[model samples]
Target: MEISRSLAISSWIAMAIVLSIAPAGCFYLPGVAPADFQKKDPLMVKVNKLTSIKTQLPYSYYSLPYCKPTTIIDSAENLGEVLRGDRIENSPYVFEMREPEMCHIVCKITLNEKEVKDLKEKIEDEYRVNMILDNLPLVVPIKRLDQESSTFYQHGFYVGAKDQYSESKDAKYFINNHLSFLVKYHKDVEMDLARIVGFEVKPFSVKHDYEGEWMEGRTRLTTCDPHAKQTVLSSDSPQEVEDKKDIIFTYDIEFQESDVKWASRWDTYLLMNDDQIHWFSIVNSVMIVLFLSGMVAMIMLRTLYRDISKYNQLETQEEAQEETGWKLVHGDVFRPPANSDLLCVYVGTGVQFFGMLLVTMVFAVLGFLSPSNRGGLMTAMLLLWVFMGIFAGYSSSRLYKMFKGSEWKKITLRTAFVFPATVFVIFFVLNALIWRQKSSGAVPFTTMFALVLLWFCISVPLVFVGSYIGFKKPALEDPVKTNKIPRQIPEQAWYMNPIFSILIGGILPFGAVFIELFFILTSIWLNQFYYIFGFLFLVFIILIVTCAEITIVLCYFQLCSEDYLWWWRSYMTSGSSALYLFLYATFYFFTKLEITKPVSGILYFGYMFIASYAFFVLTGTIGFYACFWFTRLIYSSVKID
Candidate 1:
């Protein structure tokens, strides 16, 4: 069969374009800034020190009072006057967007009439009252009232509880009132002082906020008794009364800003490193370059040596008498094996599938579709599958025809059904298991039905069309006539065995992904987030290179060993990467996963099998096509008589 040079050149050009453009698109797209570009800002609030103090009260307690230097108020004279048990009235200035109005602080000394009379007499005699209020509960208004409407209700007052978890009925009442205020008066009031204040007053605890408004209506207090010469501080201020009225307590308030940025939304460590992309790209590029260089060097050296030796031995009698190298095996090239017609069809379908895959990847590398296009890769693959079904049916039919098989319809049916049927059965079983587990990750029933419908309705028709086109075309004439008698089988070495080579071919590719598999497994099982795009891309490229090189190497060895049954072997040899992938996944489950249960295990393996199948097909195609080209090139160059 003649290969169209134009077609080959066009395919090459397409591949080049895809490779150049796809990665560029990823870089040029508009998206979230790279991690390196993001800058962290300082935190908003700062608390210098906090201390816990044991009070005379029943429970353990703590108090935290912070200070900020400011020149807003010139003197402490007004504050001192208010502290002397006098009625002080001041207009409240609006703080934190709340309307400030006239508020009165009436210092009330609590005492019975008799106690007050005695205290007054004592104070008059001493000229100073040594007794001072201690352990007073401070009540601060967190809201304001305007006209007939209550613009905002008092959120709550912070009261020092006996202990961190200690609950007072009064505190609960205040909290309930605060909840009511938050619900009724303001749509935006969502702060919880009781919850936050405990943390605030804890010794060595730090507090920071972006907005200063969170600190409104919050205060800390210290109490002193002149007679005892003792200073006591409480998270809650001592309660004071004046003329049978409750007085609002005041404390020194301070404010400051802090330096720290809020944490990022995507906290995965793998994603934060910007250098990973460049590193991965460089590694993959190096691997590819090394692979290509080695392959080319091997080809050129082997070809040159063989050609020179053949030229020198042109007139040798032994060389002339011996059957031509590749020509001797031509008789078995297209020969059909007994009871293997179905195998032939499936193998042929695989070949067609492989061809399409190669073309698609070539295009992908040239930039037709890359990660930048979102679902472009999937869409491209799906389209290629549909279009390539024609080749699949055609190749199988033509091969079956060459085998002198009369059951063309059977061959066609098998060609159409084999791959799709295998896929459907695997998928359906997996889906059933997923359904039983009630896993949301499972494909929906409708999607499963749609897939079946697509297989029967869409894929079948395409296969028929492909088969028709294939049958109408002339059969590919074998380069040499087939012999009626089968050739004798030759002895093989241990390393020359197909199984060994195929197994070996799978190793390098799997080795490339072993490290990557750890991260992917962690993401899947531990629910850890991973965004190692650069590393993934690098591993992907390495996998492809390893598969291709290993397959080519194995094909060469098999050829040298006089194993001409490379058609299927080439596919399976590279396809072995899937087995390695499966084994890796299995290992990951046992060693890396914490999952328990038969269903989860089954489900994991089931999905893994499907992925493995796809991967097998992809790598199998790469190996087969590469081997096919190498075989054709070597055979065509050799002298055949």
Candidate 2:
């Protein structure tokens, strides 16, 4: 007995050390970084550029009635030599409209000097020089140009000189002129015909422009066409040609602040200055302290005080009736629970799930499957659930047999499917709703399907095998036999009522998680990102302690009340954590979240219900088994009449 107590104390100390070090190793070690901390390549440069341009561009450019050209010059001398011309090759780009009336257009342009000359020759052959030159003014309909890009152009052009163009609100016209030049000459002109002039025609609100290495080589330009928009008549006399160029052109340009707003000063302040780690650490530490204190209290009361008191009581009772406290209820020791068959099956399945949950959480805390692994936690849990089915079948079958249940086959079949089926139905329904909403946070369809398959194939078979083994083995022999007739029930005090006791058992665990629950709620409902799995692992440990402590404490009182039918009560006492979880979630929805509609509320509670149900089962099993073992150990050692 002394050795067992020493071992338990040592194991608890070791577990505490391990839990502390595990998270420190994963998240806060001096030099070690977790695997999830690995960095990826930076975002593509083109996307960054587009994001910058959008922020800088003026609001007026998004409107219509583009600015008009001052003059049109066609003199060969005014026409600059075809500057550096190159084609922007094909690349993926997305042009989305920010407003209903706006359109976004994106396309690649190829330019060549040789092709422009060929088109000029063809136009010359078709008509006289003077006629062609005169007609050129009216040939390009501005209305047609507007219609061409209207549906495709959502947001206005993302120009560099935003300040210069702020007053005119004509930036879109300048952009359209550039686009028109590219469209007309692109097909007929060779790459050399178009030279990317200085800043006037720059890349627009393009996020990424990986215009390949070859494209970068085309950034060279020689000679300029200051008045390329003008048309000069090729008269027989040079004097006539010189007179035709009467208009002077100015490149009216302006600059404005870039539209892309960098992270706000306040946002940066919030991100870098917030003490998130400290908050989580403090909350987790408090919860752990509370859990440990509660557990220590329960251990003292139940194991230490109860043992001493019971021993004293037994000595006194022997002087009178020669019966022990436990022996007094020996007749009702093995009386079956109400709905014994169903109870056995559910408890058995719950036990299997409980073991799987423990193993999985331990592995997670140990870093085999951390948050960095994305869906690894769920994957591990699913696999363990399937593999642990046998425990469920065996426990359910054995318990049912001990209850003298005759429907072994029925019990086995129900045991195999009941819990899994409930979980599956809940999971599938939630998955369907998640799919409809296209929530990336929800489990994927394939993963859900795989879970179903695992339950039906792996878990069901193992359950059957376990049931067979359980059936083959003799039923567990109870330490005491149940009497055929019930004992006269004694009236319980107000505090001894099952409801009151169950409610009391929930307070400690709820207190441990209420603060943690806020952060969890934020992550789930507000679309916030939270990857503090290390902290969560610690909280899990605290939850276990709180549940066990609460259960043991309540169990002691029930035993003192001489209510020996503590099996389900022990389970439900700790299981009350689920109710607290639900209540906390409800509070989060009303006070912490901005959700307004009934649908969102339903979805929130619906999903929470499933999660809380699982949690209830897990915590209940922990309490039930802990108290069960403690009871068995203490009773086995006592002297009975």
Candidate 3:
């Protein structure tokens, strides 16, 4: 038996090792296939969404009438990509490896009133054009003054500049029709191949006078000749947005060989912080944990130990009657609270959220869901949430049985649909709002249907299976027996009041993570990259500890006050952090964000509401479990007979 157990443990450890390292190899982005290229190979440049910080909305590249390929083919998008408003499509711009071209004309087209209006609105909104080449995003490089090296980059360039103050009433819109692209490649000396490490663009607007007529197959431009170099002019003519204005799209390509290898290519794109802010956040969280740790230590070692010792030593019935505090309510401490059904559902949903977040963070820390993988992070989160339905079912069903509830199937159904249904309704409404605006941010019907299918077919069935297994198992053995009649609690102090205490309980947990939360919000609302998974994972652990300790501390006080309503209070104490989170989000909106439109404001608040709800579930569950374990251990250690 010992040998078999040892072998089983060894096998499990080996399997875990494999699982941890498996996703590292799949870190590359899914849409693009070519990681390295040989000489003379054709390279494709795909256009992505046009994003804006001022508007905080993303529009498809083809939505505007600049130029298009003969056949527009959209790159395959994952579920996360579809939800995130990524619309990647093929473009007329193409390039050759190790080949440079001078001033090439892509296409020319005449714009009508509607197209002009759309372009002007986007330009005014400060939308930037995004493009991708070999899974590397295109950036506009800023030249340095001293070394003449391109170190800083704007991820994407503006579609055009709007001169609101200029005297050029000729047109407020000066579209950036000319692009100069510089591709940096790293040579693989052993394989005799090259990998594209950088894709940079310099955009400009110029009114060019062409020589030949623009046709479907034949085109010529004297201003942008292949032989001579054409540079950006100090004074260029504006491309007006009047009724029949023609826009010519042109580009120049140059290749530069670099010493940086392919593996470290993304080092340029990842946001390198000063580290002082992150360290401060960590240190602040650690201080909260240490304070809570000291308080808990005193409670367990000095206070609770003394109370239990006195109660156990008492032999006379009169001596037992003289006992006070938590020992007096041993019989009523395990009594189930009212509205236990809702508590069960919340706990179960929290379990599901917990499992999903834990797995997602683990995968992220292993570098599987990095920025290189585009939408892989959200894709993994959704799939993990779906699969974790089993845990939700088991947790809720077990708790329901522990409460002596008989209707297992009803609880399971509620567990499967409650949180997801609420979120789905809110999401559908938001999608409808976006659809009215005709934005690509709205999820397509097919994708929405797929989400529904996953919920009903996969998640619901797994929840049912887990509920069945949980119901068949025996109910959890309580450390103390419940009394027939509930104990009437005396009036509590203002500090122990439910509302005040719950709110106070949440502050420490929020303080632990509010700093990191700013970066997360910025990465989402602003068009910036965030790759601080290690720091994020650490903050998450601290938040968990903070939530758990705060809840336990508060639960001890509540029980000591002879209040047996510990079940929901424990959940609420930690769950209340969401209130602070939402409030912080509101503060962030009024102060940080530039969203002016009513619809945009609605969208931001709507999404933040959902995020806060999930946080409530996640944190509330942590507190509940921590209090539960604390109560059981303290109650069990005492001689309750």
Candidate 4:
């Protein structure tokens, strides 16, 4: 026990030292370096090469307006890219709509005999198709030309994938209709670039007056003509273009700029609310913390002090009579919970979760996990979780030993497999559903297999090693020895009822995080950006402190009521926050989300369930350990013969 304590202390000190120095040597802090910020001078668009029906590449064909495909320029990978940043390519097509010569293009398609023969040979052995729609990935990196320094592109949109492309049975209909773009010009003239915000495969049938006649002859692509002066499309002034074989597909252009500045582009959504919600959340959390802290202080400084002093001076019968509340239950306070092994496992897993979060946050604060590097956050989180499995094994084994558990091997195995397996199974089921829907987001079979390998080869082995070390150490010595038979728990007051207490305890923690929760939910569901990790990290610390104080305070009351079964109750008390979280997610969905599709709803809830379950584990573990230490500290303070 002494050796274990020493090792634990040493490890923490070492980690603290490393965390303090590592950030300085590694990445520069956000907003600290002015030279790193540079504007992207000219926005570029690249077209990906052509793909086939056999290949699943999203956009494979290169698109050139008037210039050749070889004119597209690829960009270099830079460090200052935004989260989910794209590699920009110089666009072959450029327009100066303010000129007297309005650009017009009438494209004609001609089949290359040699290339057609090669395509036939490639698809000949497989189930064949005469013609496939050649999709294009127009990579448009949006850089605010106004801002000279901030170059990170936070958002971009793709054009394709509608019923026009998918449902168009004929090849000619698909080509003529699907190749389209929506042009939006602002009324203000300062905005140099017109917003080609979206592309679509609109039915060519919408353009022609003949309802049933399939236009098969020729297609036209054009811009605003110098003579026509066509600019904006409305109900009164609709699009009127020549539909002959060599006619132009007219695109009207105008430019308008708004009040949105480039400096706040990344956080435009957050700027909308003006930090009012964030302040409210912080204030709410502070109030809860103050209330919990006061309650705990009273219990520690006043109530526990009086009881301990009185117990020490128990010389008369009256003095002994006063030792009737929490002091009376000290003998059974350290008693192992029912299903001691499972409880230990939970505690261990919770420790792992805590460690993972701490390390990940530290890295994030150091700027190692930035939006400039795509998937860095998730990748870091996943790796940390896996490597932190040792904590789960060590914590669970130590607690189980303290509980006088003998089945160490069985406990460790279950500790490694149980919770993770449940999560993996749910994930796999959800992935299968996604695969059935043919969603691009589905995890491939190889990736799933790789994940399984990572779990077995890395996480499970770490758990085993940690369990071995933990089990070798002596069990923690309890201040008050357990009695042969368990103490009978007395009935409690209405507020002290487990269900009521658990429900109430959860509300404060949930309230502390609900406002931030809204922003997080918006990022996930509404496709908004979340870059406020510093604030999030602050909230996370507050949450941990709140859970601990609340659980410790409640655990004191429960013990005073002669309810010695605090092992699970302490866990459930704070863990119940997950229930509130899940409920809030449901509320957010119904109130904030306009998801009409049943599949979308199912996907949202299914993932949410997994997330909530993990949260429950993390919070519960924290509460239990806090109360455990609190119980020990108070009991150990009083002299017991």
Across 320-430, the per-residue lDDT of candidate 2 in tens digits comes to 364434445656755777777766776787787776767766766665554323234554565566667777777778778888887778998898777777867875675
Q: List lDDT for all candidates, in order.
A: 0.46, 0.49, 0.85, 0.60
Ten consecutive residues with minimal summed lDDT in candidate 4? 127-136
Residue 630 displacement in candidate 4 (angstroms): 0.7
Highest TM-score among the candidates is held by which one?
3
Ranking by TM-score: 3, 4, 2, 1
Better lDDT candidate (2, 4): 4
User: Which regions in candidate 2 have their CA more than 4 angstroms from the true location?
Assistant: 1-327, 431-449
Q: Please give the TM-score that candidate 1 achieves against the real structure.
A: 0.52
Error of 1 at 7 (Å): 14
lDDT tens digits, residues 1-641, model 3?
43245334433443353334333333554553447789888989999999887766688998999799889999877777788999989998987898888778888889999999898889888899999988889998777677575467778999998877867455478788889899999998788789998899999887766666667446666566666554534334756655698887888888899987887888888854546898898999999999998998899899999988887898988888887899889989999999999999999999989978887888789887888777777777887788778888888999999999999999999999999999999999988988887888889999999999989988898788778778888999899888999889999999999999999999999999999999899889987788889999999999999999999999999999999899999999999999999999999999998888788888899999999999999999999999999999999988877
Instruction: Give model 2's TM-score versus the native structure.
Output: 0.56
TM-score for each predicted model, relative to the true structure: 0.52, 0.56, 0.93, 0.70
lDDT of 1 by residue, 1-641 (tens): 22244235434543443333332223223452221210121111211111111100111011111122232222111111111111211212112212111111112223455533432222222211010001011112222335453222111122221222435432211100000011001111244211111001111111111122223344211232112222223224223211232223221111222121212211212232345544655575556548755875685477535753674466766766664434356556445555557655665566656665666656555544432232345444544555556666666677666667666677778877877778778767866765564333345565556556756775576667666666766776554556788765478788878788888877766666666666666554443334555456556666667666777777766655555677777778878878988988898777766445566677678768877887777677667666656655555555555
Model 4, range 1-641, lDDT digits (tens) per residue?
64356446534643453334232312335643311111222222343323222222112123211233345565432221111122334433333432322223323223345433333322221211111111112222345589775443222232211233433443121112112232222222463433222221221211212124334433222222234543322222222211222211322223233343333222332333336667778888888899989999999999999988978877877666667888888788887778888888888888888988887787777666644333456655665677777788888999888888888889999999989999999888877776675533466676677678868988898788788888998999998888878888877889999999999888888888888988888776554456667777888988999999999988998888988888999999999999999999999888877665566677788989998998899999989989989999989988665
Question: Of the pair 1 and 4, which is ahead by TM-score?
Answer: 4
Model 2: how far residue 57 lies from native, Å: 32
Between prediction 2 and prediction 3, which has the larger TM-score? 3
